[model samples]
Target: MTGLSAAAGLGRTSALAVACARDLARHAAEHPGLFPARPFDAGFFHSLGLVGAFGSPWATAGELRAVNRAALWVFAVDLQVDHVAKSREEVAALVGDCLAVAAGDAPRGPLTQCLASLRDDLGADPRWRDQLERMLAAMLKEWDWRESGATPGLEEYLRNADSCGSAFVNLSHWLATGDQWTLANLDLVRAADDEVQRYLRLLNDLTTYDREARWGDANALTLGAGRAEVTERMARHARTAAELIDPLRETSPRTALYLERQVGFNTGFYGVSDYWGEL
Candidate 1:
């Protein structure tokens, strides 16, 4: 593409990102308590909107809603679990409430209400609830590890990767706008997502180690893994993710590119910035 066309393409994606950001801001307003001003600021919303817009540039804002909403929901849950909840019981209660809403119960609070809205938008994907359960469980387990002052090895820490929430967001995206082959081969797609999730987990840890250390959140480096080791492991996962994604190109080309772009985008984004604003 020439410079002019390249600039035009970016302009279109940026416009889509603006729409996605507006929608996220409206959702945040609906559940004000869930997104405190310190961190869930305007820039954070736009950054997430860009993730959805550029990750799948072919998608319209409406088509991208599930991914954007789900990504926002992850941040809300992360803040609540990592910062707000004072006790394990509180965390467990939050988890139970979300799972209950996922199972069709009435949402008892803003968090679950937000989740209920996402669920309604998602319709029924057979694996959606299962992925939710995995993410929530991983989050609760990490909370326990942090509270107990436990130091898990790199492998173990990566196993708790669902706490990062990438897979859930990807699943929501696929359910919302996936082509038939992508939908039909979800098991395989999920396998690829899981690998990417692990990569993102470490990527996040590497980028936000200082903030995480200050906040007392679990991070591989703080847990005793060396940066060199973490970097090596990330490269390994990236290779595995690429390998898993490569085969899908023949049948689910867009899905393959989506996964590939995730690895590429975050690699660059995390090199200089993060999604959170302050706090």
Candidate 2:
């Protein structure tokens, strides 16, 4: 991540993102039969402050586009996992095609195309390739659990959450901006950043608990924890994330702030959406 100075606002970056969002909208429109009804238009990425977030050290227009494309691509695949896959067999087939595309197999569908584009943009980075593979695997594990009606423990859920594409998307920006330091030290970066992912998981669990209950999907808060207990757990992760960010600041302030911004993004969206049941 590169363009972060303390003073810059997200306006210019958001303009770029607005254009990207429109492009995604058009893509979804064009691929009517292939993607979700709302795909990528849900303001998920937009609300992330994508334009200015993530140390955006973009040096060229093409570079920025590449990053944006990869960002869109990841979200597009996630939308598939969340809304489309209906069974273990279906998920296996979907993951197989996407994995093949990511591994240089022929692109088979819109989602696979997105994976292919991201793979091309990444250009032989085995670390990110490994990361993406792990993310997809984690998604499958969660889906399998959901399908089997098995509620996971907090630790099990957290383990899967770390690789459930949330953290992978954030860390992908490091590669997008060609940050050598981040690429070289991803494990360390993820270690310091783990609590941020946990925060996201809990907040997502809280916000979507009702929806998941209605859908009969797996959720952390519903897995043997009362609302009060879940709320307290969310607080613990948030506080721990703040402490984690302090050490991260010493290593890379932009990345540190980026993590905090995600927390901000999640909380603000949660408030507005009444994901906490305040409404």
Question: Could you say which candidate leads in lDDT?
Answer: 1
Per-residue lDDT tens digits of candidate 1, residues 1-279?
Answer: 999999999999999999999999998987788887789999999999988998999889999999999999999999999999999999999998988888888989889888999899888455899899999999999999998889999999999999999999999999999999988889999899889999999999999998889988889999999999999999999989989999999999999999998988898988988899888
- For candidate 1, the TM-score is 0.98
Worst 10-residue stretch by lDDT in candidate 1?
A: 121-130
Candidate 2's clash total is 4
| Per-candidate local distance difference test | 0.92, 0.64
Candidate 1 residue pairs in clash (backbone atoms < 3 Å): none
Tell me the TM-score of each prediction against the true structure: 0.98, 0.80
Model 1 misses residue 257 by how many Å?
0.7
Q: What is the lDDT for 157 in model 2?
A: 81
